[model samples]
Target: MPAPTSDLASFAIALAEELPGSWTTEHHTHAQYPDQFDRAQHVWDMNLVAHAIAEHVLGQDAALTRDDGTRLYVVARPRHGEEFLIGAIAPSGIPAEAFRTVREPDGIAVPDDPVQAAADITVDLLPRYDKALAQVHDNAARLATTPAPELVVITLTGRDFHVSKPERADAVQVLLANGCVFDKDQGAFVLPGGDTAAQSEAIQNTAAQLSRLGVGLTVQPSRTTPALDTAPATAPPRTTAPAARTR
Candidate 1:
């Protein structure tokens, strides 16, 4: 069968399509051997596959069948410019009685349909994208409760306020979320609106929040000096009255 994309889900599906029945999937990087079995045997086989791949072997396929009819199909393929060895073990032929004594979870689920088995494997192997989305939602909810900063200008001119340098990054993030903009020229953040009592209150509240983070927003005179003209001055040109125009 043609190789699938580097995505683990697609890889699982491709491996499933090549299989004849429900089988457990295994990878060299994400190997989860059954605890009930002798893990050393599986690890040895896994190492063999890895060694072959490291030697630049491609399209290598092999099968191992136990006396009980349980079989393992190992295949090596290149993934993301690196070779990876994957295996699928068919344990359907083995009698369920063989595992009756093991009360612990096998952790590997093999659905009757190979496709579903692959889907299950994919779900287990992939990162928790849903968890990440929920985290983003939580952050948004928290930001929504933060006071919307007043955009008016503060009364202090030629003065700028800043948090402690070490905490600038985190403080900047909080200020920006509350509708503040960084003024590179002023070397400090400028609120979107200012010049009212509300502006002063907003600054005080923001400062208070930053204080909890061990940083204080304090005002200081602008350190940037105005540029001086270095060029020599020229005399102003004398202008004569325009000649009288003919009627």
Candidate 2:
């Protein structure tokens, strides 16, 4: 794909979120057929990815496919240390029917075609999505005053996982930390779980950890933290629906 205007770092980070969504939309379409990863097609795909981000047309899974013998997953950091989307389900012993879907807040839906949907985010939509996202988060924080979740999760990428720079925080990251306890070392969240009184010690630990950065760890609880799925990276289906897309 063509090099989009997005910075390399931001673009790469966006992939963790985008690929899953786009895969869902492109899952069944022959548009991104494995055979089409040609030089020119590659450029086109890159451009589409950039356009999706620019347009805020963030589908849950845009390009995912669950066909005969293929599935995809994010396996590792490759040559550029860029996360590689490994479409290697067959060799990896995964079923091909694993990847397929684009989700709306309402439900899972498949995209018709990507080529037709490829459009840049208009200047208006970019700020609009950003502003709306910010407001939802603000509301969530306001609501946090009543009941607290078991966790307020934030997934961090890049070497600075410790989240040292306050301004560098993703808007979601800030929301998760707002009006809550925190810790960086454990890399786990202790967000107002159950009774905040019981977690006072854990909360202190979390607060201390957040004061500085450190290696990956859960600061909040000792329980296992989960990784996003290869498909849409969504929690398991809420009800019977189409197959979730991943990778």
Candidate 3:
């Protein structure tokens, strides 16, 4: 189907979902009658019917059509409290008075106006999206200030654990979540002596989280390995655009 027609179909379905009452699509066939109508003529007649339905029943300015030259119609019965009944003019070569009543599927009630319905759905989903974004930002910030592996060393004399040059936000969130604290004077994440098991577990958890976020960890040289000059890296600043207001 042409892109515009496809888009119209999508729009119709979305609109239908929001409107009150049930909706159904019907295609009229004239094959049963012996009088063979010209295809072009039939399409023209159907277009007229579609326009009438859109204007009188749907209260819309224009009719929506498909790529196959089929006229689209939305048939609905407005509920008890509704001002007007919703129904469609079938393309069965019959008069609009001969319109048939189709069953409406159960659906959520929506506002009478299509634009208002769309706005309602947008309002409902925004808070969830904002919460997820906030979480991502927090995680990113934590990773940026974390210490590197080479800097994570235990001094033999004091048994003080140190983490150096931690740069990834995700990594830092994992460490912080797993009970690691920063030491300003030592310039590292310090885990006091006698908690080797807990320290190891924290490191392992940080590695797992970093892997999930697609961030690579820098391995720093410890007492056993030669220390490399690893520089601390900062996460890029993030900015969020304000949500557009509904007028």
TM-score of each: 0.23, 0.18, 0.25
Q: What is candidate 2's lDDT per residue for 1-247, written digit by digit as tens?
A: 4333223233333432343233221321113212212111111111112112112212222122333322232212212232222221212222211111101011111122112112222122223334433443453445536442122222221101122223334422543554343466654433443443433344334434443332111210111112232223443322222221110
> Clashing residue pairs in candidate 1, if any?
151-192, 151-193, 151-194, 152-193, 152-194, 152-195, 153-194, 153-195
Q: By lDDT, who's the top model here?
A: 1
Supply candidate 1's per-residue lDDT for 230: 15
Highest TM-score against the true fold, candidate:
3
Q: Please provide, for model 1 over 203-236, each residue's C-alpha lDDT reduced to its tens digit, 9 standing for 90 to 100.
A: 6666566656544343211112111221114312
* Ten contiguous residues with the weakest lDDT in model 2: 99-108
Q: Give me the displacement of residue 177 in model 1, in angstroms.
A: 3.2
Off by over 4 Å in 2: 1-120, 147-247
Q: How accurate is candidate 1 locally (lDDT)?
A: 0.35
Q: Point out the worst 10-residue segment of candidate 3 by lDDT.
A: 97-106
